[model samples]
Target chain A: MKIKLCLQKSTPRKYLFHFIADDRAWIDLLLSKVALIFVSIIILAALYHLAADAGRMNHDRQLDLIAQDFCSAINSAGKSSYETAGGNIYFFDAYNKYGNFGSGINASVSGEYVSVSFEENGRRYGSVKPLMYKTLPLSEDEVRGELMGAFSANGNISQPIPAFYGYTAVTEFLAALGTKEENLNTSMEVHIEKTLIYIHNLNGTEVKELEYILVHQ
Target chain B: MSTSLFISDEKAFMEPHNDIISTAMIVIGFVIFAAILSKTYLTYDDNSLSLENYRQAALIANDVVGYPAIQGSRQDLISAYALDSITMPAADREMHSDFFQRFSSNADFFVDVRTDDGSHAWIIDRYEASSHDGDIIAASVPVVIELGNNARCVPGTVTVRLRKNKWI
Candidate 1:
């Protein structure tokens, strides 16, 4: 009995096949893929760290510039003539390059340094600049009373006093003496005294003399 | 024939190691690029700081030439009498200190006043060479020097040299 012979054509496989010579080759492929992913993760992490460091450096530079600018303004005012009226005003705005306001921007004077600090990404950054001369911080009341006394002695109470002591009303004085809050913006008034002003310390024990006064305006 | 040709094509198969090697090379290149970029940025920052120091020196020079205490009979003039008092071998320490107080305390600098004819020269607040280890930025301004005794005015230059310190 002769069986009927039949010829059939096989269709080509649509998907490509990768032949693994051995289990070791399979393990090698798997390990290499894992290593590539690990390396990519490491590269990404490194890039992230580098970017963060650069951002921190930029923020530090901004703080430094703010301190330097405030210090320079103080020095400039100190060098001006004592007879110059209406001391110069320095406006400090803690605005970043992106035009967004910085958080917790504050400036203060302690010892011989003017320090400006701000917060970024939950981190606090600060910079300090040395003052050209001895400086004292005075309140509105103290400044006004001192000016009134000085002007009265000079027999020029009606005339405006030189170096930011000329305002007659408290409102005008406060306007010139800007807020001292730790906000996005502030102003400082720098003035030189015609004569040395003696002040008693907080304890009213030690006397300190100041020729330059930095007021929050 | 087509299947044979496709299988024989060189691009049909790639070694897995090549992927990792290429990725590593790319990462290395990126790192190098980043290093160079940071280096350039730091250089730019340093250059800008130096420029600022030079500007500060220039301002100090201008201010020194116009100082009320050292000014001659006219504006923008330096008095020989005042210069002598300030720069004499036994200069008054108090007066020198007072004069320097007019400038920023943070600035480490000195001034040199001299006549164009080399008749007179004075160094104000001369700092020792070893005191600072940095570049010196100098700015000069022309002024009229009045000889108090002879009642004569001569051309002079005031040079202000600022030591570039990290703090400033």
Candidate 2:
């Protein structure tokens, strides 16, 4: 009877050990597969981030080029205007105005694309002033469109999407030459001080005009 | 019966078991994955920092060339200071303190300005030996020409730099 009891105990114990070993092997395989899937997700995420970052950089570079072109044109025009008698300024709402002085202007330009209504002070004139400005562009619309498309495909969440991103720009222009604070509303971005201007763009980005006051009187 | 038990034991030992090798492969795969992840992060960080430096350089160059006291036409001034080109101006040494501050806030800059007759040349070089702080790399001087006493001519090159802490 004792021997029979011993055999029974031994048989069950051996089976239990084998069973545990088999289960452990299967668990290890599952764990490895899960780890592989997680790692792949991480790699994909990193790739997406890198691609997006590159795109952003490319966009910034293009914006810089546009800013440089605008600055150059405006500065050239301002120099000529300041040197002219009466400090005459030819105001153009971007497309509405084209410039030619000692430097030849290549094209005839005019349009309503540039927005402005000017108020000139009755008194002294500064050597510097607002030359031109155009509205800033925002990437919010494209981003939203893509996001909306994704949401529609997923058909998961029901939430209102924000229409636009917002941004603000603060620019300081020192009075140039003999330029002074005047009641010139040449740019909507300019503040009451007339030296510094703050521009708020509801669309995440917008190019605003920078006002320059002349240095030497 | 004992022989048969011995044979069974030998058979178990001889079975083609690759569990050890399989475990090693899995570990190696994880290690390789981690290494790539680390590399990706480092590359991204370095790229970002370098790009930031370039952008900062652009901003400083714009402001420096626009300063009134710096004098000279916009194109000429930019070419002189940022491009290391010659200038045609009578530059005073005292006038460039503001320019130096504009270059960088951490270090002193030096320039070699050479003037022959009415023509001027500026070669700007910065001490880029230190990694802990900002150092001068090289700069272009905007040259201003002037006739000194006895009808002789002299040109001065201005050095500009910024202060920086050791990054390490």
Candidate 3:
């Protein structure tokens, strides 16, 4: 009887072992759910980032187009039209004559800061006390240095011009600027009448200079 | 009586085995759940370089140029006025005012008038202005000068600010 019982047990246990009920169904289910959540979050985040990048690129493209349009106007106007109010050139006038800024980019303008200087005449009779202007987010050193050189230098300030940051729009005009020329016939005066215009780009990375001389023909 | 006692003992042993197996399954299930959660939470990629490049480009677009008009000095017009002073020069004054209006309409800016002693005063002016973009760093101011009687001159302090409006 003992030998027969051992043989039966061997066959029965082998079949049961092959079909054991130790399945990890619950563990696999939970792990899959958690993994799905993580992957979803990463996908969503990437999507958001891509959308933001697209918007920024669009904005930059618009600004670039506007800058180009402004440059064209300044160049065509012969620089003299822009030199009103020292260096202030009215955008309204430009627009009225040539339609709105071609790029359709919108911006608000405001004063950033102010400066004043006293100057003694150089080989001229009268002394001049001048007022200087600047936009916001600019350092004192940069503003002063550029103005000082521009005041003393001859035609068109030299290269390596100062760079500017911040501010949406910038303009310049001449309250008063003059030059004296002496000739063999007699002492001649070459007055630089009218205002000079400077248009600063939205990024402040570029400035368009417009020169204006009174038509003394 | 002996057979009845054997059956009762077998029942008690079977109950304990069932309890042990159930408890082990519950613990393993919880461990798997926890590992999955951690793997999802711990993964992240960095894109700081791209962010920095975009920021720099925006700054350049906003601050490439300086307002040269506001850079001029605003001192008393007595000396130059007296020398070239034509009594009742309303025409010239009107022309000058018109010029100023043209400059004023271009953009908004502050005009700082500084004295020799380093004491400074500023004026706020507005122009019809727009920007490509502006940033905190790489902003600058432009100073423009309008010479008097063609007499060379210099200002004490001149600076312009490029204000960048930040989103985010």
Clashes of each: 3, 34, 89
Candidate 3 Cα misplacement greater than 4 A, ranges: A1-34, A37-217, B1-99, B104-106, B119-155, B160-168
Error of 1 at A45 (Å): 0.6
lDDT of 1 by residue, B125-153 (tens): 74334253468889999988999877699
Q: Give the lDDT ranking, best first.
A: 1, 2, 3
Model 2 off-target regions past 4 Å? A1-24, A72-217, B1-138, B141-147, B154-168
TM-score of chain B of 1: 0.75
Give per-residue CA lDDT, model 3, range B25-124, as digits (tens).
6556655755664454334111322233233323322221222322224432212232122112322442233323432122223223232345433322
- Tell me the DockQ of each model, to 2 decimals: 0.20, 0.03, 0.02
Q: Candidate 1 on A37-155: residue-level lDDT in tens?
A: 99899889988988888888887887777777876776666655666734565567523432334435677763256788877677888887666444445543555565566543221
Tens digits of per-residue lDDT, candidate 3, A2-75, equal 44555567576764453333243454446556655665575567557656655544444334333333322222
Alpha carbon lDDT of each predicted model = 0.62, 0.34, 0.32
Pick by lDDT: 1 or 2, better one: 1
The runs of at least 3 residues in candidate 1 whose Cα sits more than 4 Å from the true structure, single-residue gaps closed, are A1-31, A93-99, A139-213, B1-14, B103-105, B117-119, B126-133
User: Relative to the unseen true structure, what is the C-alpha lDDT of residue A90 in candidate 2, on a scale of 0 to 100?
Assistant: 32
